[model samples]
Target chain A: MSNYSKVSEFKDGVKKGIPIGVGYLAVSFTFGIWAVEGGIPLPLVVFISLSNLTSAGQFAGTGLMLGLASYFEIGLSVFVINIRYMLMSLSLSQKLDRSTKVGQKLLFGYGITDEVFAIASTREREVTAHYMYGLILTPVIGWTLGTFMGAAVGIILPERLQVAMGIGLYAMFIAIIVPPAKHSLAILCTILISVGIMCLIKYVPFIKIGEGFALIIATVAASAVMAALAPIKDREGDAHE
Target chain B: MNKEMYYFVAAVVMALVSYIPRALPITLFTKQIRSRFIRSFLYYVPYAVLGGLTFPGIFYCTDSFWTALVGTLVALIVAFFEKSLVIVAAAAVLSVFLSGLFL
Candidate 1:
């Protein structure tokens, strides 16, 4: 009975992960093309996707590296861009099944991307290590495979097509934030504040900020302002509640 | 370090910074967060980060400003109604390709 249940849970997770895997294939393909176009070697590009499995962090980090930014800048930018995963990890830790082992938790914790966390946290039952593993498998494969394919194909892609595809990543970013911002005033304000800061740093001669530092400042300043102005009400399982 | 070596090292640094935030919280902390301010900051940060990265940079993505603008508008419209990442991305790319012919 235990074996049957575990198998079913793993299967369920794989089923849920399919759509996310398909999406990653498209996005990571773009990442591969962009990174290679920026002069990153094909193998290293694939390695970045395999190891990091993040969209924004990888893009920002690669952009910095191509520009020969300092290691400090790369580290700080990636950290700030990815710090939200910590919150998702915290939320997922509480939802993990009590029977899950420490080793299992640590291993699967590495797989907690935004999409994975969203699916795992919303499961009606406690998330099992098996389920997490199954959920991570397809997306990881898609991300890595897509990178490899894109890097290879990018070499032969025409310059005009490459330029057109340059808009792919930013377009995806628009797709991500637009729906939510349309629904919520706070989100709209957050986006506007960040964009305003970025513009100042770009156009204002006196500002003089590095690309990595600019991103960190904009992200922190915007998030801090929105958080202070509109604190979220405590929900169930919150310590204060 | 040579250029390739520096690139590899940078990739490693990025991987470490990316992994630590993800692994540490789940491995070390089990208790729910009590602070509303911290919770709210995390909640709002991703959107702000995405916004900061997209704009201005998106403007410079293509050869001409007009192509990028048209692509951005198409992405926003498709994403507003469709909500599929691939479709939104594809629509924008197609729009830019078609517009690039004339612009």
Candidate 2:
């Protein structure tokens, strides 16, 4: 800990943000293209990316623009998909510096994407505002910039490349969960449980539901079941891959 | 173009709706919680929810299920070794892109 100056820590935070940001860029680029291809204007796509920051929420919210969903439906969808963030933020809240100001915390609150929370919460030291800001800065740039570029070029890109880029979003999802799931039975079970539940709801005619509602149910149910059955000892220590 | 108020309004609403859940935890986390059980539960939420988000959806993201499967296999292999996120994601993308040529 002696070598860890505030500046070096800040640099480390920025470094961690880079891969997350790059992954975000590709995922959001796919969003921008999809939204635009779905008939949303470039400006609105960029606005949503700039303001929304997260992936699933924005994609769920775009239903409003497509006439396939009502405004109320879009709002409800965004909330359900984004509800996980509250838990992430709650867990992260426990990890924040004790002396951190409310206003700084408020600003810091918005940047708690899954990857950011994953990195921040696993750290042994309390996360400071300086470190948080450094961690956030690049992803903010990457997300909005990717949105702009994707929207600008979405129409012009060849069909092959556009379809190829769609894989990037799921690829990012795989990268996030596979490492931890590989090491832990609880994690592997959680994936199977949630995915199995989702599959039943998706393919079975009697139990089908809206995408947002299905996600909320799957996530909450899986988390509750696992938390009860396979509680990780707080002092068992965090896992990093 | 002039009548898009509803979309913009929806975006603002989504932003606020999303912000509360994220920000509220700050007040909760700063104070000492009385219950040890609930604290431990919150620790696992990210993992479970991340799993919920990952599978089935990953397999169905592409037009061809075969392409997606190949991509998932490639990614899982890379991620199993604890490769960086960028490498894992790129591996999935490239594997899918390659498989698309044949399948």
Candidate 3:
């Protein structure tokens, strides 16, 4: 780990980040159209793209907008959709440099999206501020720029095409979960429990609440149960430090 | 009362909501994790959350739940083979498009 210069490592991160950035362009393009077609102004769409890098939360926020939902509803939904980032960041914090400055930590946390979290966790060596910065740089730019272009020309796409592209987001989600779920029964159970909880909350009327609450409750319940019932033993070399 | 004002406000709020979660954990947790249970629980959060988000919602993405289900199933099968993101998404969209033609 000491052999490589930070510059080269950072460059490696940027290089690794390119494919993610390209993928972001496609998915965020769909997000852009979804927001814009829902009647949000182009500049506002651009503002959202620039300010918030979250995809699912942003999609849900747009829905809240269309429904003219209250500020509290919008806020709570975004919170619920994005609360998983907190978990991801907490998990990755184990890997970050101990001497990492607060400012750097702030930057690290700011970029803690699903893909960034996954990449940071799976990297072979310890994560540093420079590499993390490089890792997020391109994907962030790609995400924002894609949104701009999508909003600017989104009218070109037909409804059928948009609906078809909607699956792209779910495809990416499946790509992330399915591989790992195949490996571990705990993870498989977690997915099943979550889906079941969501179905129960969504389909049945009595406890059927807002989607935001349902999602948050389902996620928390499923993770808690799976973690307690089927805790994964740490593999060798999975040292905490 | 105008639509512009509402959207701008919503976007601003969304940005704040987005920033807090992403940044909070890094700022607060400067030490290593002490609890095995917490670690285990956190480990499953991503999987659980993704599953929660994908289902029910994926089924609702298209006008026809059946088409979306077929698409999601295609995505899962294709992803199991460890395909790239683009291919995964393309296979999903194609499934829905083809299904739409027949059903």
Candidate 4:
């Protein structure tokens, strides 16, 4: 894609990803409220939501914070929970044009969460810088505004409702996973492995690794195993179509 | 204003850090892939990450193992048949709520 076309494509891509941004806003707003109710300072809540930009990591991190966890605990927790992003970046690194500057690759890589990565990777042609920027704008704005709004309006929200807000993230996860599970045994097995491992880790006393670290190990290990076991056959020009 | 300002600053810094990873690739990479191994790798990354992320999210809500288990099973069942996000969420949340009542 030429420079001018990349700019045009960016606009088009932003339009496509707006619905996702809206969904994120709904979820992040709830997260902000949860953070405030947990006694997190509004700024801290905003920081967490903006910095992490991940429902799972921020959720786990807040769970720790509310428990008065140590700094090491918080860092370790987010690290484990977010290790999957490293893998996502690694995988996505291959799709970029080789000419992509290292700085550009590194910058765009930081925001590659589950939803953003899914939307960006599905496009047939090469992903342009402009398009990625456009995609990030709506989600970034939505998430930030949601967090700020949630924190500002925190006084009215009840604990019960805060817990209920969790359903938004859960719902989004379900929406992403269900269709693929129906079509592919490989996917179902992957899900089962992840859940089973998580369950055993959560319950089994001897194997009591902390949740964040456990998440890191489980997701990376399960994904690597799945990838090794069922290598996908490549289709011609599928990525660029 | 003091507290809010701090958080807003924190947000900008974090956002800057986060945006780098997400926007970098799209800005720089516009090249075609000619390698077979690389192509297959990209295709499967989404599926793998989706599976990895989804499975954990379903059961990680709390220590109420049975309730979470039941709720996730119900959600997965509803979700599997092409349910919408709202429907799947309702299934999971209601399942958890109802199970909480009994268990």
Top candidate (DockQ): 3
Q: In candidate 1, what are the lDDT values of residues A149-227, reduced to their tens digit?
A: 8997853246677778778767767877888788788889999999999999999998887765676788789988988
Q: Encode model 4's per-residue lDDT on A1-241: one tens digit a residue.
A: 4544766867976875675676677567778888888777877887777677877667876777676555566666566666556656655655554555666566556567777776666555666666777777778777878888888875333443434444545555666666876777766666667667776787788896865555556655555566567645555444221
TM-score, every prediction: 0.69, 0.83, 0.79, 0.68
Q: Of the candidates shown, which would achieve the greatest TM-score relative to the real structure?
A: 2
What is every candidate's C-alpha DockQ against the true complex, given to 2 decimals?
0.52, 0.59, 0.60, 0.30
Report the C-alpha displacement of residue A138, candidate 4, in angstroms. Answer: 3.0
DockQ for candidate 2, C-alpha atoms: 0.59
List ranges where model 1 is wrong by over 4 Å: A1-48, A52-105, A108-139, A150-155, A237-241, B1-14
Q: Model 1: which residue pairs collide? A: none
Q: Could you give candidate 2's per-residue lDDT for residues A1-241 as a string of tens digits?
A: 2334668777878987887777666556677777888777788878888888887788777866566566678777788877777777877776666677888888978888767877786566777877888898788888988888888886334555556666665666677777778778878787788888888888899985876567667867777787778765655333321
TM-score, candidate 1, is 0.69
Ranking by lDDT: 1, 3, 2, 4
Model 4, position A60: C-alpha lDDT score: 73
Model 2 chain B lDDT-worst window of ten: B32-41
Could you tell me which 10 consecutive residues in candidate 4 chain A have the lowest summed lDDT?
A155-164
